[model samples]
Target: MSSNKQPVINKFGVISSSYYEKLFKCNGQNLYKSRSGKSKPSYSVTRECILKFNHTENLREKERLKEQLTKNILRCKRRLGLRTLGSGKHVNIPGGWIEATYLAQCKGDIQEEALNVLYDSLDHASFDYCQLPALFFVAESVLYRLCCDAFQKTYLYSVEMKLAKIGYLVFLRLFVFFLHGHLGGFKAHLLRLQQYLNVLSLSEETYYKYPNIFSNVAFILKTSEIIYERVLLSESTFSPNGNTEGYENVYSDMEFQRHLRFNQGGYEVNHLLWHCVAAWSCVQNNSPKLNNVLEHLNFHKTQLQNKCWLDSALALLVLAEAAKLNMVCLKALMDLVRDFILSIMSAQNQEESYKVNDFSWAWNIVYTYVTILAEICLYAATSDLRKTVFIGFCGCKSSQKNISLKDTVSEDEPVLREASVLGLLKYFSSKISENCNQLIWTGYYGLVYNLVRMSWELRGDEEQNGLRNTIWQTLQKTKDHEKDERIRIAVKIAQAELNDPTDPFTSYGTKVPPNVGDETLSKYIGWRIANTLSKLFFPSIDACAVPLKKLSIKQVQRKYPKKKEDPMKKRVLHFTVREHPSKSELSMFPYPDLFTRVDEQLARIVDHHWQEELKIRQKEDAICEAEERKDKELKEKNHFKEIMKKREEKLHKQTKPYELPPRTEVISLESKERNVRKVTDYRFSTKIVQLQTGILKLPPSAIQ
Candidate 1:
C-alpha cells in the first residue's frame, strides 16, 4: 500500500486494512447494491464509519474516511438522480430510500450537496409529463432533513421558506413517517404545516385531482377540526384543581394555537374515516340529523362481509361514535359491537402459527376495535342518558326525565350503572383470556384500559366487589407476563388507577378520568393530542402514557380497607391470608373452598355427560336388539310362507284348477244358501205361529 493511504478503524477500534480498501473499491451506492462481504453498508455503517470521526485514532485516516464518506454520498446522490431522471416506467423505491439514507446520515457540505442534487433532479425531471410519486417522496425526505438541520441551527426563517416552497400538501404526505418518533425536532413542523394548510383554502379539485397524494387529507382535515372543537370546549369548560401548572400550560398552548378549522371532503382512508368525520362534526354541533347519519352507517354495516378487518373495525368505530353521541341506542349498539369484536377474535383463531405480514396494521385494527368498545362502554357507564336508556331497556319504571346528550353523568348508585359496567368487564375479561400469542400489545392495552377504568369507576359501590377480584386477577396476569413495554405500562397504569381512583393521570388515552377532581385542562389536551396522533399514524407507547412512579402500591394500600371475615363463612375457611395473592390465587379467585366448588362443578358436568352417553348407548343397544328380533321373526314368517307356497304349488300341480277354485266358491255359495234358508225359516216359523194362534181364535182369515 502507498504511504498516502491509511487503514480505517472499525467500530471496535480494530485496524481493518481490508475494509479501508473495500471502501475505496466501491462507493456506498455500489457497495449497498452488492453486499457479498461480511461488512454490510447499512444506515448504521454510515453513522459509525463517518459520523463517529473519533472512532479512529489516526487523524489522517479520519480525514480520509470523511472525504470518502462525502464522495460516497455524492455518488449515491448521482445514482439517485440518474434513476429519478430515467425514462423507465418503474423506479426502484428501496434503492431510492437507500440513497436517501446515505444523504440523511451525511453532514456539512456533503449533506447539503446531496439534498441539492435530489431537489434539482426532482424539480426538473418529469419524464412522461407526470412526476413520479416515489421521486417526490425522496425530495420531500431530503427537504425534511434540511428543515430539521435548519431548525437545529435556529434558522427558522430558512426552514419556513424551504417548507413553503416544498408545499404544505407534500408535508402532509410525509407527516405519518415522522409519527413513529424517528424525526425529533421536525414534529414541530407538523403543527405549523397543519396551520398553513388549514389557512389556505384548497379547492375540491385541487385536493381531489391527485387522490393518491391526498388520500389521508380528509382524515387530516377532520382530525384538525375535532381537535379545534375539543380545544375550544376545553378552554370554555376548563378544570383548574388537579395539576394546575400543567393545566395552565396546556390551556395557554391551545389558546395560542389559532389554526383554521373547517370540514373538508376528499378521499378518506376508508369509509370508517368518512363516518367518523361526519359523526364528530354532527356530535360537536348536537345536530338531530345525527340519527340519519347513524342510519346511513348502519345500512352499510353489511359491507363488513366483503371488506377487510380494518373496515369491519372502522364500521364498529362509527357505530360506537353514534352511540356515544346518543344518535343510536346504546343497548342495541352494544350487542352489535360485542358480536363484531367476538367475530373478529374468532376469525383470527387459526390453529397454524402464521407470521403476520403486516403486524402493525393488524394490531392497529384490533386496538382500534378494542378502544372503540372501551369508549362506548365508558360513556354508557357514566352518562345519565345511557342510564335512562338502560332503565327503559330493562323495563324499569323509572322517571323519563329529559337529559341532554352532553350532560355530565353523575356518579349514581350501582343499580343504574351496574348493567353497563358488568357487560364491559365481561368483554375485557373475555378478551384477556384469549391466546396470549394471538393478542397484540394494543389489544392488551385496550383490555387493561377498560378493566382499570371500570374498576376505578365502580369503586366505593359495594355492588362491584365481586368484579374487583376478576379485574385484579387479569391485571396481575398481564403485569406478570406482558412482553410489550406499552402494554405493561398500560397494565401498570390500570393497577395504579385501581389503587387510587383519585389519581388524575390514570386516564391513559382519554380526557375523562374516573375521579373528575384529578382531571385538568392539560391532561385533556394531552389525551386529545395523543389520541389523534395515535390514530393518524399508529398506536404509540407514549400515546397512552401515565405518570411514572408518582403512584405507589403503599399509597394504594393505605386507601384500601381490610375486609372483616364473615364469621359464618370463616368457619368453612381452611386457608390462611397472605399479603399478596399467590400464582394460583391470581389464576383463580382466592376464596374459601374455591377449588372445591370448581371441582364440584366439573364433576357434575362430567356426570351429566356420562349419564347422557350411557343413555345414548342403552338406546342404541335396545334399538339393535329390537331390530334383530324383528329380522328373526320376519325370516321365520317368510320361511313358513315359502313352505306353504311350495305345498300349495304341489297340490295345484297334482289337482286341476277347477278343484282349487271350487274350495273357495263352494264355501261362499254354501254359506250364502244356509244364511238364506235360516232367514226364510225364521220368517215362516213366526208367520206360522201367528197364523195358528189366529186360527185358534176367531179372526185368523187375514193371516191366512
Candidate 2:
C-alpha cells in the first residue's frame, strides 16, 4: 500500500478546490408538473356562495342564496358515491423532481408518481382520509426540506416552522411497515436531515435546556448510517443510467458534497490504513472534500463528563476507530479520553441530581469503548499496526495527576476506599494476567491493553459475530466470501447511489463485482491492489446530530399539558401534581373540519359517498352469505336422506338376524360341495355382506 497524504482542512472545512458542488445542496426537487391542483367542487361552490352572500344585504336575496347553496351542497354529497376527489386530478406537475429525483429512482418512479399527485393535492389543502402514505412521504420530505432551507436562510425559517411541527408526527412514522426494515435508499435523503441535527447540537447548551427528540428515530437513523457507511461500503463507481428495472431512468445522479455534509454522513478512516469514503472523497480530481469530522465533536461537553454524560460518551466512542489517523490525532484522542474518564471518577464537587433510572448510559459507554479498544488491540496483536501507534491510540502514556487516591477517599465515606479504582479495569486486567496490586494505576499501555484483550474475549457476543465472520473470510480469501448476499440482491436494490464511496462519479469497471450485470474480469493486478489496500479499515465519524424541533413541542406541552378526559364526569378525584392543564394546546391546529366552509361541505360530501358505497358492498356481502348458507343446508339434507334410505333398507331386511344367529350354518363352506348343489334352490343360504358396513344406526342428536 502506498503512503497516505495528510489532509489540510481550512476553517471552511475545505480540503481541495477541484470540480465539485457547494457546501449545502441547494437544488430543489422538481415537483412542479404544471398541472393545476384544482380545489374540490364542494369547496369551490361553498366558498363562492359565502362570498356572494356576504356581499348582499337584502334579507330575501340572502335567504334565497343560502337555500340554493344548501341544495348545491346536497347534490355534491349525493354524487360523491360515483367518484372521489382524492382518486386523481392532483399532480399535472411541471418540474422534474416530482417524478425524477433520487426519491423516484428505479421502480420507485411509479410509486413516487402516485405519491406526487397526492402531495400536490396536500400542499394546497388539508385532508387525512384522502390519502395516508402520500402524506407520510410528503411530510417527511417537508421536514427535511425545512431544515435544509433553514441552513440556507438561517433566521428566515419562522414562516414554515409551525407547519413543520404539525408534520413531525407524520414524519415520525417514516416506515409504513417495520417488517421490511429500510427497503429504500435513504443515504442521500437523510444527509440533509442529519446536517440540520448537527447544527442544533453545535454545543450542549440547546440539548439540556431543551430536551428534544434526539433519543427518538433521528439517533436511530444516525447509528444505522454509521453501520452502513462503515460496513456495507462499495468500491464500485456511480452510473447515471444505473436503474434498469423497466422504468425510465429520469433521475439525475449528480452528488454535491462538502466537509459539513461529510461529517454528518458518518465514518472517517485514518492515514495509517486508508481514509473512509467521505474522507477519501476530499481528494477527488473533479470534486474533493476534507476529513474535518473531529471538529463536530463537543470538546467542552466531554471535559465535563458528569454534567453532560451521554454527549461526552458518544463523542469519545465515535472517535474510537478515528484516533489512528496520525500521531497528532492519536495523541489528542488519548488525552481527551483519559481526561473524560478522570472527570467521571473525581467529580466530588458536582451534585448527583440523576436517579438510578438514568444511569445505564455509563455502563453502555464503558462496554462499547472497551470493545473498540479490543479491535485496536487485535490490529496491534497482528503486525498490522505497531504497539507505539496503539500506545497513543489507547492513551497508555497519559496519567491522572491532579486527582490522586487520597483526593477520592475520605473518612466520611468508608466505601470510597474500595471505589478508589474502577472495578471494570481491575477484573478486566486480571483476565489479561496483569498486576493490579499497584495503587493509583499502571501505565496507560497496560490499562488499555487489558481492556482491548477483554474486548477480544467478548468478541464472541452475538452483535459482533457477523463482523468477525466477515473479517475471517476476508483474511482466508475463500471463493465463497465473494458471494455476498448484497450482490445477490443487487438487482432488486435501487442502484441510484449518488454519494457512496463504492459508487463513485466515474469508473473503468475495474473493481466491479463479478457478474453484477458486468462482464469484466478481475485480472487487473493494479486495480486489485488499489481496492485491497483501500479496504484495510474505516474511520468512525460522529457529527453529534440531535433533533431540535422537539424543543418547540416540549415548550408548548410543558406550558399547557395535555387535557384530561371528561373533567366534568370525574366529580371528585384524588389530589395530584398539577391538575387541570392550561387551555388551548394548539393555537394553529389544523383539524380536517377546520377548513373553510367550502372544504367542510366537500368533506361531508366525500363522507356521504363513502357511506353509500360501503352500504352497497355490505348488502352484496349479506346476499352472498345467505345464498351460501341455503346451499349448505340443502346439501346436508340430501346427504341425510341418502343415509336414511340405506338405514331403512338394512332395517327392513330382517333376514340379517337369522343369518348372523346361525353362524355354524352360515354359508361358511362355499366349496366344491356347495357349488355342486348350488344349481338347486338356496334362498336361505345367501351370504350376508351387511356386517362389513359397520354404519352408525344413531341420529345426530343421539350421537351427540
Question: Which has the greatest TM-score?
Answer: 1
Summarize candidate 1's per-residue lDDT along 499-529 as a digit string, tens digits.
4435423333233323322210011111232
Q: Which window of 10 residues has the lowest lDDT sum in candidate 1?
A: 517-526
Query: Which sections of candidate 1 miss by over 4 Å?
Result: 1-269, 279-292, 302-322, 327-336, 349-363, 372-382, 385-421, 424-445, 453-490, 493-704
Residue 670, model 1, lDDT:
92
TM-score against truth, every candidate: 0.28, 0.22
What are the lDDT scores of the predictions, listed in order? Answer: 0.41, 0.32
Clashes of each: 0, 24
Write candidate 2's Cα lDDT for 418-475 as tens digits. Answer: 1111322322222222322111222222233233223223233453343333333222
